[model samples]
Structure formats: structure tokens, C-alpha cells
Target: MNAMTTLTYFFPRRVLRAVVVLLSCVCLAASAAESEAAEQPNIIFILADDLGYGDLSCYGQKNFKTPNLDRMAKEGMRFTQHYAGCTVCAPSRACLLSGQHTGHVHQRANGPIEFRPDPQDISIGRLLKNAGYHTAMIGKSGLACNSQNGNHPAEKGFDHFFGYISHGAAHRYYPQVLWRDGEKVQYPDNHGKEGKHYSTDMFVADAKEYIKEHKDGPFFLHLSLQAPHADLNVPAKWRDPFVGKFKEKPHTKDSHYRNETHPKATFAGMVTNLDDAVGQILDELKEQGIDENTIVMFASDNGPMSEGGWDRNFFNSGGPLKGGKRDMYEGGVRVPMIAWQPGKIAAGETSDHVSAFWDFVPTACEAAGIKPPADTDGLSYLPTLYGKGEQPEHDYLYWEFHERGGKQAVRQGDWKAVRLDFQTDPSRPLELYNLADDLAETKNVAAEHPEIVARMREIMRKAHVDTELFKIPAN
Candidate 1:
């Protein structure tokens, strides 16, 4: 009944209750963090619009500057001979997200597409989402040109979405509005085409905000840049920095004339702007203290459209590869690729192994420690990136693009074959090149190696079966 007796009697039971609650909370917190980390590695797949193999300083372009991209090359693995699925944007992006080569994923060509990503077809976000990683696609979606369709990023299995639904919409950059999580999120800059505003800045700002907010867990950030593409204008401040350094009318490696009004200079400026954007995002990763755990990959969706690709004439965006976009040549599909993940991939290492855009889905899944959805076509390049694996992870990397220039290529080991197939007929004169000996693809060895051509055709048959081309409307 005294004060000391009452206090002593009540204190022990309450102390015991407090100890149990604290221990339980600690266990729950630890469990949540472990579950988060186990979902996979954080991935940032940065796709540059219409970028070329030689645009980056590290790849081969000399006139223009790209300190950030070059710096990434220094810290990560660089693929000397990388490729896109198609010569154009939409198909290339489709193959990339689907993990199927053009032949195995997208059945048709150049877009402004008529159809959306097939619901049946697996997407990178969908595959990763199934395995528990938080997936998103920001910036240019490249899924559809129209706003009303189901081609928005959210429809493709992305948990969070921003940027434009189509590449055409992003041409405005500082457009009137941007879509966030499948709806329009209005912004102040409503410059309605009388004068286009700077968009690369807007894209990077949103991307940085996303990274800042998502640092506590793993994320798949596809910050697909719309810069250096078309309408070729940017913040004049960035352009003025290199007005005199490059010539515009492009100069192609061939007798074909390069488009210059001093186009290369504008292209270079665009490249520089993209580099600055990359710097912003990478800086954020470092600031957030998640740089080491992040797997960041930088690659072009396809080759240059102009003579210099991103730049204009003075610079060669495709380096020593063959033709530019819309062609079946190496320059059309081949691109520069850099994969950076600190404390994982070997620094400054270069690989001649053939890599196409489809590899991204599987590689990201692998880095995140997540398994892709069932029946996925991607094979992870994780071991190769780390320098612990063998050469040629893929038996054959195939493509099918039917636009102004309809073509397809298959690379099996050192042997490569390309076809000039019409919309209905894929069986035609196949161009075979031993890429090991000829990087530019100047000579046709199909006549010399009939056996190799046959093998490539056999590969195409399987690709056709897997792609199910018959389902596509034949119009």
C-alpha cells in the first residue's frame, strides 16, 4: 500500500512489455530491408535518342565533348561493337523492353506505330515487376505517338511513369504538360510550338527528383532522353558553347554527302546537353550514397540520323561502322554502349562481344538479383560485364526492321548475315560479313560462304516461329 511497494510491483511488467515491442520492431525493420534489397539491383537504363557509336568521346567521336559519358566509360565496361534491334526508334525500343530481337519481338517496322506493345509480349518492367522490383519508365516512352492509347508507360507494367508517350511529343521538350502515373501533370512552360522550350533540363530535373525519393529501395529508371533527336534545337546557351567548333552539312564516310548547315555542331551541342543531363543523374546517385549498388547503362536506341548522327558533319557518330540510321549497314544498327556499376564491373575494360539492346532487360534483372518472367528471351551479360565470363554470350543476335530500308541481321559468333526482305518476303539476297575481319561491313561474303548463309536462314526460321509474324495484320 506504500509508495515504494506500488511502484516496484508495477515497474517490471511494463519494462518487460516495452522490451518485447522494441525487439519486434527491430526484427520487422530488418526483414523489410532484406526483402527490399533481395528484389534486385537498382537499374538506370539511359537511352539516348538517335545517338551514334562515335558520339561519345570514349567511343570515337573527337570534335564534341562528353565528359560525363566518358567518365562512365572509365569506371565501367565498354562494348566496342554494340547494336540496336532496328535502325529506327520505336522498333528498337520495343526490342529493348521486350528482350526479343526485332525478329523475335516486333513483327513490323518504322513508327509512329499502329499497334501497342503486345499484352502477351513480356516487357522489362513487367518481368522485373513480377520479381518484386519497383519499375518505372520516365522521359520518352516511344510506345505510341498518340496520347489516347494504352501505350503509356503504366500500361507497359511500369509502376511509375512520367515524360511523353511518344518521341514526337517529346520533340517539344518543355511541352505544355507531362504525364505522371498515366495522367497529365501540368507544368508552367506551355510553349505551344511558336518557340520550343528546353526539354532535356526538364527531363533531368524530374529524374533527379525520382532518384532522391526512391533511394531507400531498388528501382528501374528508364530515363529515355529526347534530346539530340529532331528539330535539333536546344538552350542556345549550350549551343553557343560550340557554335564554331563543328560544321553542319554532314559528311558521311562514303561518297554520300553529309548534311551540314554546320549540322555536326548542333549535334555536338545536343550530345553535350545529354552529357550534362547524365552528369546530373549520376551526381544524384553519388549524393544519395547508392552509386555502388546501382547498375547504370548508357546506350543509343539507334544510330545517327544526320551525317554526324547527334552532332553534324565534323564528327562521326557511328565511328567506323557502315551507314547511318534507316540503312541495313553496321552504322544503322551498331552503336556505342557503356555499362557502369561500381564495385561490380571491371573499370575501363572493352569488349568486342556483340551486344544488342535486348540484353538490357536480362542484364538488369541479373544485376538486381531477380529472375525474369517465364519464357523470357534475354540472357544476362552479368558475368561478362564483371570480366569473369566467356566471349559471345548469344548464339545469334537477330533484327527485323521494315521502314524506308527494310532489313534484318543475324550475328552468330564471328559470322554475320543481313537480308533485304520486303514486307511479305524475307527470303532474298542475304549479305554475309565476317565482322571479325570487316567492322564496316563493306564487303559481301554471302557468295563465298554459302554454308554460313544457310545457317543464318535456319536461325531466322526459329525467330519467325517465336515472333509469330502470322498474327500481325498483313496490310
Candidate 2:
């Protein structure tokens, strides 16, 4: 006899009816759950390594045009005052993932440092995964120093992870081996100096595949592309287009990165290649019919680097900002940020919201209709995106870098203060600037504004909590 016949025969009519009703309710609840999961929006965060704020044409690049990114800006909202977590890679990513600023984040510097988060600390991947979303991190994940330990991407709540586990490994454009979840996948063709495969292209392919596989429901894909970072290498197809577009000056120096024949052309090509990859991911989302249900955010990890023979001044990579890369100035920390979601975020909108990378976690949580962690240092700018509700503002933003003799910066209203050599001398004098009047931060008005300087110094002192690994001397 069938299971249903057996059940009916073993029970009374009322009991059998109750059994049927219970089964029906269970099925209905499951169906409702599946529907809810499908209804939640997909999130794709694309991070470009070492891409400058003004690298894209939309952000005032006169050297090369980023048509796809420009199109993305026109179709979505562009943020003019978005800042990265820090001036470097590892710490910056740590702050972004942990939803905390550099002041209280683990892995404050790049090196052979262990990424040991607090027991209560929740990563962005974990935050989304707990909400019934499939999470995937494709491309460079510079947080972990050891992949086998608890610091691995898998352990950090990513359901699927593919790419370099360390920052040093990510410097190469043609990597010999890449991590697939917890396994190391080898590429024999890319074993030597020259290779048939490019790392960024592989990352894009994997990202596209992940989107296709998870097209039905809620998913969070962190697509981190290592491009325009170093080596100044790209296939002829991407580099050839900009070969003769600019004045020629070959880079033949032997440094950390390989020398380039035409540094400017190759750099421009790398950016354009990055732009193309973004376009492909967008196209894939549209083809899967999830464009309206997916929100794509594009931003660089930090500012541009002068490494790998790439010319920052030739391309004006930092735009009107004061310094590039390593510095604590606007050019180093401020980066280009774009958000695209059809029928959700308004089109052709530009917001001067002073948001930072740490805010991503809360903003994404709010977008997915979930609550962010209570200990998070970031505030969601969801209201600004939808042009509804009263958007919250930050009282101040803080950043501290361990490298380059230690740097600390604080931004409050129109005033900005920077302190150098803080690790050695915590009571160092701060260089103050009125950003409202001098956006470039060319002048130091610390002597003129003593009270403001005192207030900023107090903030810097209180914001930083000394850690065992990266400690700032007590004031």
C-alpha cells in the first residue's frame, strides 16, 4: 500500500484529516520560504585594486575613457565623497568586511600577520549568509595570511571562494595557482613569466558563472579584480588600443614590478580592461533576468599606486586631490563609488554623501531587509540611495595606517586633521586644513585653529584602541 493509504488505514478520519492538514501546512511554509528567498535582491560588489578616484572618464580621467563605468554612473547613483577604509590593501579590506573602521579592526597592516577577528565580529559574507543568501568571494582576498587556519575565506562565512588568499600572491597578473574554496587549483600554462591566462579574466569568468548558477535567488558576490595594480601587464588586445594614444616614455627600471615598454598605454589598457570586465558582469545579470533584482556596487580598494612603472601624474590619476596611495590625504583614502540597481536606485543621480567603505555592511544589510551588527561603526546610506527618509550624517570619520611611520586622520565637518609618526609619538602635532575652503589640503592651519586642533587630537586619541599586533603608543 502507498504511504498515504497506510496512514489513512492506521488512523481515524479526524486524525487522518489533521495529518493531511499538517503536511499541507509544512509544504506551504516551505514554498513561502522559497518565494521569500527569491524575492530578496542579489548584491554584487566589484572592487578594483589600486584604481584611482579619477581613473574613470566619469570621474575626470582625460587619458582613457571608461564607457561601461560611465554608463553605470548614468544609470545609477555616483558618490562624490566616498572614502576607502585605509590607504593600504589588507587593513582597508578588513575594515570593509568587519563593518568597522581602521581604529578597531584586525589585520591593520599587510604582511605575515594573522587575521584573528573577535569572537563576536561578523563578516559581510556571514551577515548575508545568515539571511539565507548564497555568498561567493571571487578574486583577491587579502585578509588571510594563512588559508588553512580559521582565517581562511571559507571560515569567514563565504560559501564559495576562488582567488589569491594573500596580497603578495595577488600582485602577479598571471598566477600559477589559485585557491578554489579550500583547495589550491594549479595553472601550468601560467607557471612562468609569460602565460596564456590572465588572472582578472579568470575572476570575471568565475563571477559570471556564479551569477548564472545563483540566478534564481538571493546571493552576495564579492568580485574583487586585481587590475592596474602592478606589473603593468595585459594582453595585446587590451593594450594595443591605447599604444599610440599618448606621448611615449618607456619604463625600464628593475623594481618590485616588471618593466613596461609603454607604461602609460599599458596602464590605460588595464583600466579599460577592468571596465570591460564590469560590463560583462552587468550583461550577465541582465541576461539572467535578474538585473532589476540585483544591486551592483563598484569601488576601488584604495587610491592609485605609483608602482609598476605606472605614471600617476601623466594620467592625473589622483585628479585635484593632494596625495596618492600611501598618504593619508584625500587622494589616498577617497575613492570612486557607484551603485546600480534598475527600478530601485534612481538613475542619473549624484550624491555628495560622505560615506566610507565600512558603511557597506550596514547599507547592504538594510537593502536586504536585515539588521546589521550592533557593534558596527558604520551607518547605512540607504535613504540617500532611495531619495526617501531623513539620511543620517556622520559626526566624524577616522583612519589610521601602520605603514610609513604610522598615520592618523580625522574628518569632521569642514575641518580635516592629519597626524604623522603617531606610533612613536602619540602626542604629535596635527596638520589641520579647512577642507571646505581648501579641498586639496595644501595648507596647514593648525596654529591658526588651536581649539579645533585640540578637539581633533582628542578624537584621534579616543578613536584608536591599541591591539597586541598593531599598537599605537599611549598619549
Q: Count the backbone clashes (under 3 Å) in each candidate.
A: 23, 0
lDDT of 1 by residue, 130-165 (tens): 666788787888555444653456667789887787
Candidate 2: stretches off by over 4 Å? 1-28, 117-121, 145-151
Put down candidate 2 lDDT per residue, 1-475, tens digits, no spaces. Answer: 9987888788887998888899999999999988877778999999998889889999999878999999999999999999999998888887888889988887777777645553545789988999989999999884563344423777778999999887777888889988898888889999434698899889999999999999986999999998888878988899999888888878886666777888888898999999999999999999999999999999998888988777678888998888878899999999999999989899999999999989999998998879999888899998998788989999999999998789999999889999999877777789999988999999999999999998998898898888777777865
- How do all models score by TM-score? 0.84, 0.94
- CA RMSD for every model? 5.5, 2.6
On lDDT, the leading prediction is: 2
Clashes of 2: 0
What's the residue-level lDDT of 471 in candidate 2?
77
Worst 10 residues of 2 by lDDT: 142-151
lDDT, model 2:
0.87
